[model samples]
Target: MATLRQTITNALLMTAVVSMATPVTAQDCATPGQWLTPGNQHAEAQPPMGWDRLARQRVVLLGEQHDQAAHHRWQLSTITALHSRQADMAIGLEMLPRKVQPALDQWVAGELDESQLLDRTQWYRYWGRDAERYLPILRFARDHRLPLIALNVTPEQRRELSDPASHQWTLDQRHGVPVPLAASARYRQRLMESFEQHSSEQLSSHISEAFIRAQLVWDSSMAAALANASHQHSLVVAILGLGHVQYADGVPHQLTRYGISDVTGLMPMAAADACLAPTGVADALFIAEPDAPSADTPRLGINVERTPQPLGPDRLVITAISPDSPAQYAGLEEGDQVVAIAGHEVRDTAQVRALMARSLPGSLIPVEVLRAGERRQQLVTLPSPSP
Candidate 1:
């Protein structure tokens, strides 16, 4: 029998968008077997089938692209279907932190409104400008009184996991030590490969090592939490970014290491067609689009106006520069139009930020300016960005 992962991959490969010109009838989506073939080996496989069996799985890890609304919709639908069977289910989310668990729990228990549950800054990062796609999931969890566990690793831990040399050093030197493990010859070769893939560099070696180590710690913690849950709970679903849940070395593998062999990983197929394949820990996957994409473009701090022209795309504008920053030290004033950055056209704020973000401290970046209808170039030594 094909694994649930394989089945999800097949379903995603065969997905077609519903159209208003040719409306999709109920028969088209009733179930995979009714409209699509089961294990059909031909070019055109079937849609998702076996919902009844899938609903019975003990643990379901619903992998998602943070920005996709359609994936969220499909996730809600799948969860609702499983709920109808009266399966005891809990949702683990990556957006919130473990420290905020009490607040999250209180919100889920109908003690808080949406605003209290998700503040503006937090909401913007997770949902972006599309509040519609995210609000429903929060509502559903609240209505069901399901527990919402925060599964993301802390920022300090994330920094630690991104480093590599610390993995070779003393355990005390590590910021957050991974659960100690005796050498398992079975995993020795894989461990070597992991080490090789995540080598540290002069500037970034520590950070990279820390990041990997943190992942190990996080996976172990998550698995332990899941395994310790009441057996009466039929399913535990974890919602996380694709990066953390994609590879065999990711959380699912860590879960297996902790003795939870019976686990299923699912990802939204629409985000990346390749994720549907059962290459690593992902057991089952589905792909779906968001209801709509967000239209708000990100804004940058700088604006420019060209000399002798009121407004034009090339008329660069400098909205704001960091206080006591290199640009400020170089006599760059707000509303002083940027003629160029190192002789390149100042098209928009994005280019400016990108150039600045990558600049090393004390590196001289040439800035051409149009101030009071005068053109001048200044060499500014950039300061290091704060950690």
Candidate 2:
């Protein structure tokens, strides 16, 4: 089975757009699967407290991959459901920096157009440029007059934290706010393990420390904002990245330390594979209708790291060949300058990728390369990408 982490990433980072036009009803979503520890048993005939229990909590965290359209739909629906039950709630967003809180206020007050709201917030610079993607949630907030709070430190603050001099408590602390809490030992270790996945650079103490520092401050700040907003009879719902909601390792941990005791975490699990043996991932793993999975891109099955050729026109050279790959079988080797395929010039890796997307398995690709100062050509069969 795919890990919960991988499943969420696939939904979040897939290349194809799974567009959503309207909010998804709870009826439209997959019934959430419970992730219980092995040997744990419930005494009640009925299952545990569901969304209503969540509504009664002081703080409710709806974790999302942010880029997934369906995740946004789930968020909107959940917020609407909570509102219908007369839950006094305000939503904090991970997208905008605290500097743009006024812009959010103006928009919620109906003083700004969608285009103007994005501009005032400097959307692409701070969050992202896709305003239409979040219109559903924004519209809901405006319609209901719910507070839309900005939930991040400024970009300048982020840059300062990255500086070596900013490590001191006084230099980094936000005025009047508590200093950001350090991540627990387990959280730091997990963060480093994740950092190692996408980073090609050799892991070093410095890299890990810097990344952990930034992440702690991020989670801590968001946690502080949510805690402050959580007043008597008020429930604060935070929309955040999936990584920040794992177990009690993230925002929940920080909030707990700050004395916000009652917090619940909910993760969305798409409908097709909703029910499974408990992974013990969160309070609940609900599902949304999956977007159409994107068509697989054809591959040459090569692990060649691209290197830039700088003397003249920018070009790419193969740093290495993947084992058991078409390129290796066809005699492509390290340090070979990739020149073309099937008479089309290979200006860069993107061109090759574009070509491969059109190729089928068993299709012969005539690859040209410069190896050991001499030009050579080989006909290599394309391969299907791994499932």
Candidate 3:
């Protein structure tokens, strides 16, 4: 019997990244005409000539850091620019799992409001990392009547993919596309680095294998979804993490397994985890400056519900504590009235937002909440993902 790794390698070699002119070599990808501007810098400036070439391609990918507000800004700018050029396109989002496609459809069709859409998609639970960052782009899609495709695996599917005992091979091979591929030496090294940062445990070979498989599931699923949605020569603007769109080895490479060929990958030049090896980041780069995050950035790390008929803008009540979140560690409880955060009096959601904008994740927060009509003060430790 073939080993799982052998099976994966064989499936990958069979579909080698493309049937196009050729797999874009390291040197061939970053031609003068392919490099684009940064997300923050592109707002006031005209897109470079390279963008024109990319816009003409079958699929264009814009990579971002999920919590980076400016990346979403740049994505919207690029999408609107392409639309202005009369390009027929649809946007794919990694935030929404495929199960929420109906919510996406309803949102774009103007049948659902923001709160309702987020609720219907289980946004806070499944995608609770942060939705505010992408809200503007979602609104943009709805306002422009653009198609939005939910390009992600459901939580259940994620579990299935991560479990070595789960039989996903047959399903993965169902459409003759293999989700697992040979990890490039660079990719493997980077994966280990990321793993080490978040885990105190040793990076055992078996643990590493499971982690890589999970990553493959995300990459391959998005690639397949984009390929299916691109029928009729429509352009696809994929908004996803920089990691998945950085190297051609991610979604772009997965696309070639279906023989779809034409793909242009671009990443924000400001990404912290940029693939520095000549060809790893993307086909080209989008230049953008990082935005200075506000103090009221809401790093208190709790999902909040506004108190009914609030006394002020900061009169928010805690609804839930995100597991492993700072709020959870701070002993915040449901129905706790958020009276102050970081010593700032917040009477409502807006005030809380303002206060959080001024704070950074991992910063010490002195929070005072009215729980059971008694005031309690707690210190919160924000969990910020490393840039």
Candidate 4:
């Protein structure tokens, strides 16, 4: 059996050489000339031209990298272009969950402003600052009165599904609920494999497991949302991460499994590259290149120095401390500043993580912290490796 690392390497290699041989039809909108603006700095200069053809299909999945501002801008532009062409519904967002679904629905119904719609913590948890990128899509959805579906798994449900032992039980519960069989099986198997491969005693097993479970929940949620929207609208658009939207095994693949076969997946090409390629069930794919940065921006964060920086008012601050984690067990709290680790001065988040990674599980590491302007030292023993 191939190892997970080997599998990933092979997949990436295959992705590199697989040329999209099918010629885009004239009616198909794979060309860049249709959607992209010339010399547009805010938007991609050469956006995937053929999305109009893809948009005509039953479902159009737009894959995007999360932090790429250009990709988000292009996504908004694509939605606008499709709407102008009379597309009806937009479904399956990775960021919005059922808990906040009502807010999204309200926004689409023009009952709430875009800011008011997504301002809740429940909607912003996984999104962070990247939520700003979706502003345009939110505006479009609200302006057009198009139905916006919330397609994300809730936190509690995600935790339940990530455990391999709970798979059968979860399946039994969600059965007959329009959940795609193939998609669920694939997710459970992949998540189990990922857990076994990446997990060890040193790190929190539940943390990693929860992350994977969240993905499975997100997938199932998106599928359900898509099925419902297809019944109400002819052309449904799904905006999600490139990973969730790419490959034959993603949301589109699950849609095909459920017998919803008509779909197209569009992804923006890196500015350095051209030519769009088909992903799994997608009949059409388009690529676009955005503009380059005006000047080189130096990357931030710590520089590796054997000696740590002096503990001062600018000491490294703790943004979060996982519950039941070593930091938490040691009584570390958010807003605490790390003055020293294992008697060595610590400078930043990177250094703190590095120190933790190097320490063996069960070893006691002395941590000096400043909490509420009071200096305190504590000895924290790392937990056993998580299965």
- Runs in model 4 with CA error above 4 Å? 1-53, 164-214, 271-285, 290-387
Worst 10 residues of 4 by lDDT: 295-304
Once fitted onto the true fold, the runs of candidate 3 whose alpha carbons sit more than 4 angstroms away are 1-49, 165-169, 172-178, 271-280, 296-387
Q: Predict model 2's lDDT versus the native.
A: 0.66
Error of 2 at 373 (Å): 49
Clashes of 1: 35
lDDT of 2 by residue, 179-219 (tens): 56767786676676666654555767876676666677677
User: lDDT of all the models against the reference?
Assistant: 0.52, 0.66, 0.66, 0.56
lDDT of 3 by residue, 75-131 (tens): 888788877765577899877788789999999999999767876776654554456
Per residue, candidate 4 scores C-alpha lDDT tens digits across 1-387 of: 134323332222122122223353323223443332212212333333454565666777887655566777777877777777755666557666666777777777877754456444244343433345677777777777787777665545544554465555644464322333344454444444544444343335555444444454556667767877788887888887665654546677567655787766666553223332332323323344444543221111222222333653346676666665667677777776678878766554444554554567667778888777699998787665554
lDDT of model 2 at position 99: 80
lDDT measured at residue 169 in model 3 versus the true structure, 0 to 100: 72
* TM-score order of candidates, top first: 3, 2, 4, 1
After aligning candidate 2 to the native by TM-score, how far in Å is the CA of 217 from where it should be?
A: 0.8
Question: TM per model?
Answer: 0.54, 0.63, 0.66, 0.56
State the lDDT of candidate 1 residue by residue for 274-309, as single tens digits. 222323434444535334543233222344433346
